[model samples]
Target: MIKVSEALAIVAENSSNMPVQRIPVRKALGYILAETLYSPIDMPPFRQSAMDGYAFIHSEKHQYDVISTSQAGDHSNIKLNENEAVRIFTGAFVPKNADTVVMQEHVLANKDSILIAAMPPQFSNIRNKGEQIAKEEVVFEANTLITPAAIGFLACLGITEITVYKKPKVAILVTGNELVKPGKKLPKGKIYESNSVMLEAALQTIGINKTKVYKVKDNLKATKKALKGILEKYDVVLISGGISVGDYDFVKDALLANGVEELFYKINQKPGKPMFFGSKKDTLVFALPGNPASSLTNFYIYVYPAIKNRMGFSDIHLPKLVRKLNDPITNTTGKTLFLKALYDETNVTILDGQASSMLNTFAIANSLLIVPDDVEGLKKGQLVTLLPIN
Candidate 1:
């Protein structure tokens, strides 16, 4: 087995670089931008009024003639003369020679003229052209994630669509005749199958929605046919179970039989020791151990990064930090142990149920306390690497 870091590096080098395509700005949320976004025109495209009252040149003012009124979306370009004001509402274009706007509540209104009871600072209520963004200004850098505010800002710049990297189309295969679907009666020694559902939800959290799931018996022939079909259609294939060297384990053999070359077999890590990675042409594949916690851990560490790389994201790993251990733990084996942990403002507590098949404490976990393989024993208050999960 190789170190976890080495396995990550190999997967990084082998990840597929998906092509970028133009999509509607509304559909680009959470997607990495493939190109820089520039403002098409100056924000607002005109000098605009920032308040509702009157628009006029600032000076030692008392009363002035009220010209025509202008509200938001008005196309009229009514000009203002000296000592004259125009009734203007918020977002209305500031007519020529108008330099300021006073709030309606602070002004005394009459039929012909209005008194400026409270004078605003010169040019105080005027939103000048290009105040928010200039024409052709670089609004967003390449690889910037599109947010809700970005959508609003892009709409202001008259942008209807943007270019972004495409999300991966994934196919999942859960192999094992001993596995039974949820809601069905547990007959004999069979357990409820949950890997596909968990993985599908995991993929959804990363913004992948185009996914198909299939189930196959442990037989080698059936597994091979299923792998071949999924490999032909999907960009990524995730197989749960049949990776370990057991008599019924046929994932490795099935992959090789279908021309899927193995890149790695296992990592020097606990819970997910028998993880397998492979790729054939444009389709990347992962065969995770059947244990619930083990498969989930492998997905977060290896599969998540590979998919993120294809989506053109810069950071492809879980958020990590160093925290003081709240309790003592021991690692008798050479494998690096990843313990489910709960953390507060500063400290992290390693919870119970670190077993590969047990997931009772996983629901309460917010991070994984990584105990290195070389470190056999750790005491409380020691600073250890922690990987945050939401």
Candidate 2:
């Protein structure tokens, strides 16, 4: 068996980065930047008003007269003189020779002349040219995820389109003869299928909205047929269950029979030790354990990062938190264990009765408490590393 980190490295090394494509600014949200975006023009290209106020020479004190009103998008080439003031709204361009802006509330206005009650400090209420951004400077770097704030920033820099990595198409295969579709009454030992829905939801959260799901029986012929059909259509293939050494586990055998080379199998980790990876042609396949918690945990720890990196994201790991364990938890000194935990601002508590097939506990978990394989157990209030799950 290979170490978890080493197995993860193999997956990362084999995955290919997505190609770059030009997309409209409206559709670029959640996509990763393929190239650095430089500002073609300075943000706020000209000096503008930061508030609704009067722009005038500060030294002229009470000798200022109202000349004209300036709203947003005013292009009048009017310049200010000593004792002359312009009524400027927020985001309007500041006129020349206006050194300060006195708020409207502070100015006593008459028909012709305005009496200044309080003089604002120099450069007050003014947004200077290039103050937010400079011309020809990098506004966003490559590999940065395009979020709402990033989109707004790019628009502020006058960018109408951007280059981003193409989103990967994922195909999910859930194999089991005893599994029945939802809404159907289970017969004897059969249970309703849930892995397909869970995996699809997980993929959608990371912006990979394009997905196809295939339900295959545990028979070798049926499983092999479905796997071959999906490999031709999707960029990445995720198969849940049927990878272990049991008689019904035929995923590894089918892949090898179809000319798919096994990259690695069996990581040294609990709840997901039966995970395996293989590749045929350009399609990458991950065989996750059948148990819901184990499958999801392996997907987060191994597969999700590979997909993110292939999509051109620089940061592939989830955010981690240092928290104190609220209960004592014991584990064997072999495989690393990721315990489902509930963590908030005040406390982090590990959930009791953890089984790989259970789903109720995972739904309420906010973080995963990582227990090293070398440690036998942890006492209450012990500091531990927690990885947040979205």
Error of 1 at 33 (Å): 1.5
Model 1 compared with the native: what TM-score? 0.96
Candidate 1 clashes between residue pairs 3 or more apart in a chain or in different chains: none
lDDT of 2 by residue, 82-195 (tens): 879999899998897787887889989887778888877877899888998999988888999999999888877778999999888899999898899999887999988899
Clashing pairs in 2: none
lDDT of 1 at 105: 93
Span of 10 residues, lowest total lDDT, candidate 1: 74-83
Which digits, one per residue and each the tens of the lDDT, describe model 1 over residues 284-362? Answer: 9999999999998888889999999998888888988988888888889988888889988779998888899987888
Model 2 residue-pair collision total: 0
Whose lDDT is greatest here? 1
Model 1 clashing-pair count: 0
TM-score per candidate, in order? 0.96, 0.96
